[model samples]
Target: MFRTVTRVELSELDMPRADLAEALKCCLKKVRKGHYIIKSNCPNSHVDTIRHLLREPGITFPTFRGDIRDDAEKLRMSIATRRDSLLPEDAFSHMSAALLHGLDPVEVGTERVEVTRPAYSRAYSDLLFYARDLAEDDVDHTLGYPVTTLDRTLADIALDHPLEVSVPLISEGLRERHINRESLLPRLAPGRRGRKRALLALELASELHESGAEAYCAVKFHRHGITGMTPQVTAYSSTGAFIGRNDFRHEKALVVVEVHGVGKYYMHPDGPNAAARQNHQRNMNLVNAGFKVFNLTFGDLFRPKIFEQIKWAITQALEHENH
Candidate 1:
């Protein structure tokens, strides 16, 4: 979710660099280089002046605030800009709506904005418009722009994208409590295209998964027939002392699988060295408790060879437990 900064509309003016800077100096506050913020209370005359200046070249007033460096924020700005330029009847849908509703971007690219309008389907420039009738419950204006509700957006994603792309998003929505399966399943009825894939994704969706990567990892485990694993399992010693909460655990096999991101250590609040030390200590504790730890990276999870290694690890751990 985006932090609500000062609500300001951004205008990408077409004028000489120096002239544009001078023109906006009086009515707008220059927030970033080449970007200005038009305050909500700006005089109507100043607004008229901006409108007149852009009579020849059209202007899109995208309302966004914060660091433009963030990719998610950039995508939000893109969605806003596209929405501002579109007809009032059009509403953001599919992946674009999912982003607005705070679902992980996942496999969806930010290059094109997805929209829906009655009796209209076309790809123009950076907008992919769908032709579909939206029910009243499907549309929302909570963000000050027309966007599909969370359930509707998930349904659209399930219909349009594969499980690899859609599962993470659906899982996220469930985890966030933004939408429920009971609400979303009806949208993917019997006659709908991609219903099977959507149903499978919904079946796999779980609120217990912490991140999109973990959710995707669950899908991978399901596909590879890696069974008997539970998510977010807490590990304990034979004496009933807590060791740590694991990403995944198989009790019978006495195995714990941890999915590590590239910046897991570096992005910690404490220094990376401290984070690494803590992780090392945790691993030692888990090992001392007779739990075989299998640490998997994002890259490792994507490659099939790593799963073979994991299978071997699981088998070895199971044999050890039996012995």
Candidate 2:
């Protein structure tokens, strides 16, 4: 969202008049002197006089040096005339707005801007505006400028980005555990007419399990008639701090299961390796204190080998529980 100048105030310091003019003049040269301090193309000399006129309407800078006030009215007036330009997208600037809005998934580079145009549009050949066709629902507004909502942003990313790129972003949200799922739902265009694949993509995106991995494991678990196992369940510490809610929890046994994804081995900037390592140390401490830990990777989660392994582990834990 964009912010507008909601209010203004004036203050005075015991600084000398020449030094004050020099400082204010620098502010004027850098940005507009009004309500919003936007970048300006004004000279230093004229800026000081404008600052003086702001303090007192009839005051001239060379003649009126006593307790001069900055001009609030003229500053506000300069920006008020350019109200239409005060959009959030304006802050993003050029192709940056497109990536920020989710019209496209762009590489997060320092200076390279990325944008997308309509499928039929002519290519501009500008290195900055790397264009692509927009899905109808992807185009929307934030504070009256074009941008995509969070859901659409993620969906677009899923469709366009590789697992190495996408997983890190998703893992960051999950590891921090502060993803705003409710607000993100609106941006998902669920049906065929709109962003048809987005809802499914979102569900897939949240899955920590590799594709088809959990399904394979679940089938074997069900076939064995594992009475105590629950899939897609929540987990908590003894303190009930809700640490890493899991894929499965055997309530009777107090054991948590996680179905790890493929990227677990990859070293991304926000890779699961670091998070998993930290979790492993904590989980070891829990096990040392007589808690149960059950983890399965993409290799294990999808394999028949994992079912036998888990069956063994559960049997051993159940024996300990009886003791």
Candidate 3:
């Protein structure tokens, strides 16, 4: 394939002298000082430059993907590289590699730098280095050129992380529609370390359990006998007008159950009550429009008192159902 070549010419280009020189270097060989022809398999950077110069007002060239990455592709690859250092050669079949490939805000914070290798030393209390070989292909990349894959990521996390940690991550993936049980199951080789747990986690996962809190609330709500509540629900009026979306809603009782935390609710830097004011207004609008809105806080959901609050909210919505 490298035998056949594409020919291009260069002259007084609409660029600086240094740029003109660089353009000349993009060619396979200079036909003369002012003209040149480039090989089809020329480095992408060179080919891209030639393509750009030739592809002006009337000039057209067939688009071909070359060894050089476009600016956007370069950016993606750069990020992917920084995220994971394992090259294609290493047998990086390990969980740390998986984490590096799929590290998000939930798994590790933005500033957290992971150095995954088969070494362990407690340098910093915040930093952790797992003592395991990074098996090649143990993970897939977040970007196209990345080493680890998401399926590998799920399996590894499921195997290595605690149930509390892994379930939330898997739940978020399922709830956000980025992953599915069927796709992940096939990726798990028989006798894989985390296959059983991963399969169980996927089976119990639902798109409605958006957050760890939400996922926990779902199970607890059911245990508390709170039926008919749909998670991450959108409510609409009888006339099809848009009512605000509820974290959980029961259509039969016209009840909207929502959880609140400092992060989920947006607040202006100017004042403490800014988010409260906006939220209150929306809740009041729903109430006036004939929906019983129950605002549940983290405390309300996690504590023993959650049962009473659930009963009260359901009773209120049910009693006002006739209205």
Count of clashes in candidate 3 = 14
Q: What is the C-alpha lDDT of each candidate?
A: 0.72, 0.44, 0.53
For residues 26-137, could you state the per-residue lDDT of candidate 3 as single tens digits?
5343432232343334454534534554434533222334522132222222233233334344323223343334432122221222334556523333234445455555
**Which lDDT tens digits does candidate 1 get at residues 144-246?**
7899988898888888887767888888888785578999888999999889889988987788878777777877887787877788999888899888889
**Which of candidates 1 and 2 reaches a greater lDDT?**
1
Q: How does candidate 3 fare on TM-score?
A: 0.48
**Runs off by more than 4 Å, candidate 1:** 1-14, 17-77, 262-269, 316-323
TM-score, per-candidate, Cα-based: 0.73, 0.32, 0.48
Clashing pairs in 1: none
Q: 2-82 in candidate 2: lDDT tens per residue?
A: 122211322232334564356445542223333333123335543443343344333212111131112222222332324
